[model samples]
Target: MSRVVLRRCIVRGRIQPARTSDVRAPGPRATAPNSRDGATPRHSASHDNRSRTEVPMVSSSVGGVKSPRFFYGWVIIACVWVANFVTVSINPLVFAFFLDSMSVDLDVKRSTLVWGITIRMISGGLFAPYLGRIVDRHGTRWPGAVAGLVVGLVLIGFAFTSNIWIMFGLFFISGLTGFSIFGGNMLTMVPPASWFVAKRGRALSIATSGQLFGTATFAIAAALLIEAFGWRWAWAIFGIVAIVGVVPPYALLMRRRPEDMGLLPDGATSLPVVEVTSAVASPTPTAPVASATHREEPDFTVAEAWRTPVLWANLAATTLLMVAISPFLLFRNHYWTTLGFSPTLIAIGVALDPFSFAIANIAMGFFAERVPIRFTGVIGGVWRGFGMLPLTLGMTWPGSVVLHNVVWGIGSGTTSVFQTMMIPDYFGRTNQGAIRGSITPIMVTVSALGAPLGGYLLDAGVSYIAFFWGIFLAVTVASASFFFQKPPKHAPAATDPPTRMPTST
Candidate 1:
C-alpha cells in the first residue's frame, strides 16, 4: 500500500493540506537540514500519521478541475448592474417625472413634495452606519433582497397615497431600505469593490453606469406612461419593475468576499503559496505569494482609517458634490419647464443625457485604471462646472437644455467612477461597509437639504440662473479638495498579531 504524506500549504491565503504519495514504508525518521544546526530530527510516524488523518481540507475545485475561463466576479458585477438600474430608476430618476403630476394631484407645494426626497436622504443617512455593520457581519445578499422588496413596495404605495404625511412615511421607509442599501451606492458599489481589487475602478464604472442607461430608458418610459395612463399608474408599473429586477439576482448571486469562495480577487487563477514550519520539519520560511496582476492592499480598520486626513478630505468633497448635484438632478425638468421649454424637448434632453453619461463612463473606466483618481475627480468637477454655464442662457438659447445635459452627463459620469473608487482604494475592503456607512450621515445631512432648499429658493423668487451659478461654485470647491486626498498610510496596532499561514511538516 502507498504511504500518504500530508503537508500543510497556504492556498489563496487559506490553510489547507497538500497530500502526496510516498512509495517507501515507515522507517527511521529522516533528518532535514536546519539553518543553525545543519540537521534536525523529524517527528515520529505516529505523530505525522495522526495529524494527516484528523481532517480533510475541502478542495476549491472538484476533481482537480481548473477554474472556469469566465470569472464569477463578472457575474456579481452583472447582478449589481441590474440592481443599480432598477433601484435608481424607481426613485430619484423616475421620480423627477412624477414631481409635477404628484404635486398637482396631491394639492401640495412642490417644496412639500420635494421634502419626501429630503426625508428619504435623512432616514437613509441615519440607517447607514448600522446597515454597514450588518453588511460587514453578514453579507449583502439578504439585506439587498429585503431592501429591494421595501423599495418596490414603497413605489407601489405611492400610487395609493394622497396624504402628504403618508407619502413622507413611505419616503422614510424607502430611504431606509432603498436609498441606504440599493440606490445610494452602498450595496451596488460594495459588491464590485469587494469582488475586484486591481480592476476596481473599471468594475465600479461598469456597475454604476447602469444608472445612466436606466435613466435613459426610464425617462422616456415615465413620460410615455404618464401621458397614457397617469402618474399613479406609472409609479405602480415601476414598482413592479423594481421587484422583478432587483430581488432574485441579489439573493441568488451575491457573495461576501472572494476569499470566502476559495477564489482570489479579479478572477485570478493562480493560488499563492506560503510555507509554514512544524515540529516535524526544519524551518523553511517562504514569503506570501501573490499573482503578478494583483497588488496586495493594506487593510485598515475603520478606527484606524479615521485617524487619517484623507478620509476627511474625501468626505468634504463628496458632501459638496452632493450639495451641488442633488438639487440639479431633482430640479432639471422643473427648471426647464419654467424656462418655457416644451415637454417633448425636456423629455428628449432627459433621455439623451445618459448617452453622454455612458460615453464618459466607458472613457473614465479606461482612464481610472491608469490615472490617479484625484486627477479624474478634478477634471470631472471642472467639466461639470463649465457645463452649468449653458443653463445661464436659458430659453433664449433653446439648445442650451440639451447642451447642459450632454456636458454635465460627461462630467457626472467621470465623477461617479471616482467617487465609487476613492474610499475603497485608500482604506481597503476589510471594513469597507462600516467605513462608508460611518460617513454617510455627514454627507446626507448636508446634501439632503438640496432638493427642498432648491424648491424653497425657487418659490421665494430666487432665479434659477443664480442657483445654477451657485452650484458651479460648489463643484469648483469640491473638485479642488480632491488634490489633498492622497492614500493614507496604514499603521498596524501593536497588540494585533500578524496572520500566520498554517503548515504541516
Candidate 2:
C-alpha cells in the first residue's frame, strides 16, 4: 500500500491543496473521513505502524499577521488633496478672478462671459451619469489623468482666444472632460468615501479642504499674476500648474478602493477568516472570508435610492441652496467693486473667504463624526442665511464686509462637508458614484440658471441688495427642508440578509 500526504494553504482568500510524494505502507491503507461531517481523523501508531506527524498550514500575510507600515489610504487622500487643490482652482476659484479681465479682453458683457460657466455646467451635468458609471466600473486613475490633461490645455486655449464663442466652446469642452472626470465630487470626494468607513467624515474633510486652501492661495496668486502680466498670461501660468499638479499624482497614486490592495477599509490590519476542515489527519488551513461587519453597510442601487423620499428631499434642499448661492458667488467681486473697494482690497477679501472656509471645514469635519449630518446642514443653512444680513448692510460699515465673509465662509464650509458625506453615509460605497451622478442634471439645471439670471437682473436694474435678500430667504427654506431627511431603507430579496441601516449619526 502507498500513503499520500496533502498540505493545504490559504492564498488570496482561497484554500488550495498541495500534494506530496506517496510513501510505502504496510497492511490496509489508512482512509481519512469525509470533510463534510466536520470530524477530525484519528491515527494510532500501533495499529497502523506509522509515526504521528504534524503539518503546518500556510496562511496569507494579510490573514496571518498585521503590517506596521503607514496606511496607503492616507496616501490616496494626499493625492486627492493635491488633485482637488489644483483642479478646483482652475474653474470657479481662480476663474472668478479672470471674469472681469476676460470680459474686457473679449469685448463681452460680464453676463455673456459667465454664460461660459453655465454652458460648462450644463454639459458637465449631461456627462456626469456616464462618468459615474465609469468610476464605478473602471476606477478613477485614467479618467482623472485624462481630465487633468484636457483642463490644462483648455486653460492654455483661454489664454489666446479673443473670440467669445470660441471661449464658450472651450468651456463646453472642459465641462465634458475635466469637470466630469475629476472635478467636484467625483475625484476629490468619492475616493475617500470608498477608502475609509469609520474615518469617512474626517477623511473627506481633509481631502476636500484642498478646495478652500486652493481658493485662498490661488486667489492671491491669480490677483498678482493678473496685475503683473495681464489676465492672458495669468491663465497661461495656471494652465501649466494644472498639468503639473493634477496629472502625475492621479496616474501614479490613485486607486478605487482599499480592497484592491488586499487591505480593509479604515486601515483594518487583519483579514476575516473562516476555518476549513480537512480529512487527512493534518492541520486545517483558514481561508479569508468577506467581513460580516463590512457587509452590513447599506448598498442601495441607483434606482432604489431614487425611490426613497429622503433622496428627493435632500436633492430639493441642495438645489434650492445652490440656486440661491450661485449668482451671489458669480457676482460677488463685481458687487463689492460697486461698493467702492479697491481691486487689491477685493482680492484680500476673496482670499479671506476661503481661509475662513478652510478653518471651519476642518472643525466641522470633526464635529460630523459625532453628529448626524442633517443637523450640520440645518445649522449651516441658518448661519449662512444670517451671514447674508451683513451683506445687505452694504459697505455702510466696511467691517460688515469682513463679517459677512467670515460668517458665510464658516457656514458654507460646514454645509459643504455635510453635503459631501451625506450620500455615501446613507448609501453604501459600491454604487455611490452612480447614485450621486443620477442627481446631477437636476442640480446643474437649477444652479446653472444663477449666473445668467444674475447677469440679466443686474442689466435690468435690479439691485444686488435684492439678490442678497432673496438668497437669505431661499437659504431659510432649504434649512427647514433638512429636518425632513432620513436614512432610506432597502427591500432585500428573500435569500439576502436584512440590511442594516447606519446609525442616524
Candidate number of the best TM-score? 1
Per-residue lDDT of model 2, residues 1-505, tens digit only: 2233332111222222222322224333222211111111111112222332323333346553444367788989998888777766556646778888888877888888888888888778778788888888878888988888988899888889999899889888888763522223576667899888767778988987887788878888888999899998987887788889889998999999877877767765544422223233423322222222222255678987898898899888888877777778778778877878777877787788888888888888878766677777887887787778877755555666677778888888888777887778777788888888888877877787877888899889998888778778888999878866766645444454322323222
Global lDDT of model 2: 0.70
The TM-score of candidate 1 is 0.82
Q: Any idea what lDDT model 1 has?
A: 0.72
Which regions of candidate 2 are displaced past 4 Å? 1-60, 64-68, 178-184, 273-295, 495-505
**What is each predicted model's overall lDDT from 0 to 1?**
0.72, 0.70
Q: Report how far off residue 397 is in candidate 1 (Å).
A: 2.4
| Per-residue accuracy of model 1 over 66-160 as CA lDDT, tens digit each | 35568788988898889878776545656788888988999998888988888898888888888887887787898998988989999899899
Q: Which pairs clash (backbone N, Cα, C closer than 3 Å) in model 2?
A: none
- Winning model by lDDT: 1
